[model samples]
Target chain A: MNKRNKLLIRKTLISIVMVLIVIVSLFPIYWMLLTSVQPRHELMNYPPNFYTRHPTLEFWKFTFKESILEFFNSLVIAFFATIAAIICGATSGYAFARYKVGGDTLPFWILSLKFFPPVVAIVPYFLMMRTLRLIDTCTAVIITHMIITVPFAVWMIKGFIQEVPRELEEAAMIDGCSQLNVIRIITLPIIAPGLVVTALFCFIWSWNDFMFALILTRNKAMTIPVAIAGMREAHGLMWGEVSATAALGTIPIIIMAIILQKYLVRGLSLGSIK
Target chain B: MTVKKRALMLVLPTVVVLALIVIFPLVFSLSVSVRAYDIRIPEHPFIGFGNWISLLKNPDFYSAVLVTGTMILAELFFELLLGLCVALLLLQLPRSRKIFQPILLIPMMVMPVVVGYMGRLVFEVRSGPINYFLNMLGLESLCWHASPDLALITILILRIWRWTPFVMAVLLAGLLSLPMEPYQSAQVDGANIWQIFIHITIPMLKPIITLVVIMRSLEILQTFDIMYVLTMGGPGAKTMTLSLYAYITGFRYWDIGQASAAAWLIMIPLSIMVTLFVKMMEKGEKIEQAK
Candidate 1:
């Protein structure tokens, strides 16, 4: 074969493999969506339908009936938690980026806190929340979820802020703008996109949390993942309801994931990428 | 205010928040570990490592450690391999990276709880797609999460599926940002593709590979939601990771003292390792930047 043909064949093979990876990666989620709408009997058939022949709104209703509250709970909690995380994370990120807060050591120590396992702190957290009569409340869930997202937000925003050179802020400062005003007028606008990405990530982390919501909330403020756990109790595992709830829980993040694709490398690596 | 005070004002909220939520919990949980503090028990007394002693003797704890160890190792191996392959492939086809990158990230975005339940639904022995596809291919069906032998594998498969894209993303970023002079120089030296990849690509990607490995392993060590929803670390404790074991003990069994002990058991070593590892990462990044 000619050299050009060899390259063509190689390209085709790579495309084929890429197609396979895409399918494998995305099929489970598609399967989950399909299972959510599959008729009850259809779900348990000898082989579950690859495509639902007779899709139903039954499982959606059954799952969403109880899940709607939890869904909203998840949304509200994640929103508030992201706000808390951003407010704290952005300021600290700015401080670290601009002021070199505590020199390099302090920020790494704080960043290391991100790696601390949930298992270690959760038992005490549960007790603390209980003592404050905060169990099963949105406040408790939001606070606990904030623990996970804040480090992420700080690290992410720090990178974004660092990318905005000190010259811009210095120009403002030289114009007699106070440090605070320099931040408000120049830094905030510059890092706003980064903040949005960081906040979206915080929102997803809060929304996707099962461990915190499971331990922190009971009925009053049960989040969507907790609602899935609740399904496990009613029936052995309502595959349909579980699928429906899982699909519902992931829809927001899936949308956000697409939007944040460009930023995800930076976000997921906690700004290590940049 | 002086610049220092202004900086403090910017950073104080974060420090206070971390103190309350992060550091306080560390000290508090460690304290709980030393005491006989089960919610089931009426009296709370400082036993001074009695809980730790009992947990050391607990067979369930050992089993959990074994399962978690196996799972983490397996996931680290598979995700790195698969993620590296996909990353290399995407790098080869730069034009298609845009089309494929977002789709590949869908699994990473899917909720872990959703991953757990979705694992159950998609891998169910009798009616799951795996078995169905297997039977269609004229192969005998194998029980996935239901079988003890396969439970960890099922979890690993799902874990890798969720995270390989993460590995791929980070690696892709690393690949994309790789300094070009080395490759061009290597080419001028008449290095073959294999030789160039071995010397130049691998060396340049080392920091990212290390980061992905350490980060993913730490996560797999704490793998809980999947085992919880999919198997409850069950089929005779075949899949009980340390986190799940601690969770079950602390929450379900209400054995707070032992749970606290187990949590510390995971945490203490983990803290040392992670701190050191993160420091290495910082050092590595500095070296990379300097180069």
Candidate 2:
């Protein structure tokens, strides 16, 4: 066979494989969306309707009516958690990057916390929150979620801060700029993109959190995932309502994933690879 | 302030937060692990290593360990293999990757809890599209999560579907960042694609492969959200993972002391693994800097 033809054949095979990968990756999400809008009766079909003829907004309305408060609760918790993580984490990140604060072991000590299993911590946090009278409150969940987000913010933002040249910060210092002002003026602008990425990731983690939210909050501050889990009734899962909630919950996350795609490797890998 | 003092001030909040959130819970959990501390029970009696001994003896704990181990092995194997394949394919088609990569990542972005529910809907024995597709292909529909034999496999399928993209993205980034000098030299030596891949590519990608392993193993260890939403370690504990088992023991049964012991059992190896991986990661970074 000619080289050109061989190359063409190879490209064709690759394209076919890529197509299959994309389809498998996307089909579940498409199914979730399709299921969300389908009429209840239509979903029970033996050959399951791949395309819904009669789309309904009833589940969407029901999700909003039942879980809107929980959704708001999630927003509040994730927001405060993200903000707190960034404020605390950015300072430590800058210190670690610029000054090598805590030396080698201390930084890894912090990084290890990122990987600590949430299940282990949940038991104690539950007991602690109970004693503090913070159970079932957003405060408890927010504090609990800090376990995940703070370590993440520290490492991710530290990596970003490390990328900014020391000369720049040094130059600002020579100009008699105070350390705090130097950070606010010099480091912050340079690492602004990194800070945003770190904040977004922290937010997404808190937003998508289930186990902590599930364990910590009962009802008053139940996040969206907890609310979705509670959608079940005596007659098996209310699949449509569940799907509706899942679909809505996923949209913002999907958008964030796309937006963060550039920094995904660094963020998701906890800055290990980058 | 002196430079040292300023540095200390900067890191204080983080230290305080982590100390409160991470360290305190950990120490509290350790104390709880030693006691007969049930939330339902008022008087908590200290039972040194009692909970630990019983947990060690429990057949169910062994089963959870087995399930968690099998899952980590299976998911890591499949995800790494499939992820490498997809990354190589995307590398070949950089143009198409722009459009398809984000589309591919949609699964990873789907909340794990939702992924669990999606698993239920998609793997529904009779009405799930998977069965319908099977029927179309002239195969009998099989019960997925509902069947004990297939329950873990069902969860594996969903998790692999969600996480393979992350693995692929990381590997793809690694592949893109690879220096062209080696590939060019390999080409001059008349190495075949497979030879170049096996010898040149795999060795160069070792650090990245290690990174994926570390991250994915940690995640698979904590595989509770989906298991909770989908199986709840059910169909007779066929799919019980470590995290799920701990959750059930702690929350549902409210055997706080035993659960704390179980959590510590999981953490011992986990913390060891983390410490070791962090050391390896730093070593890898030093090598990169030297290069």
Deviation of model 2 at A207, angstroms: 1.1
Residues A6-75 of candidate 2: C-alpha lDDT, one tens digit per residue: 8889888898988887887889889989988999888768878889889999889998888798989999
When candidate 1 is compared with the true two-chain complex, its DockQ is 0.77
Scored by DockQ, the top model is 2
lDDT of 1 at B90: 91
Candidate 1 at residue B223, lDDT? 82
lDDT, each prediction:
0.85, 0.88
In order, what is each prediction's RMSD in angstroms? 1.9, 1.7
Residue pairs with colliding backbones in model 1 are: none
Model 2 agreement with the true structure over B201-257: per-residue lDDT tens digits: 999999889878977888888888888888889899999988888889988898999
TM-score of 2: 0.97
Best by TM-score: 2
Give each prediction's DockQ, rounded to 2 decimals. 0.77, 0.80
TM-score of chain A of each: 0.94, 0.94
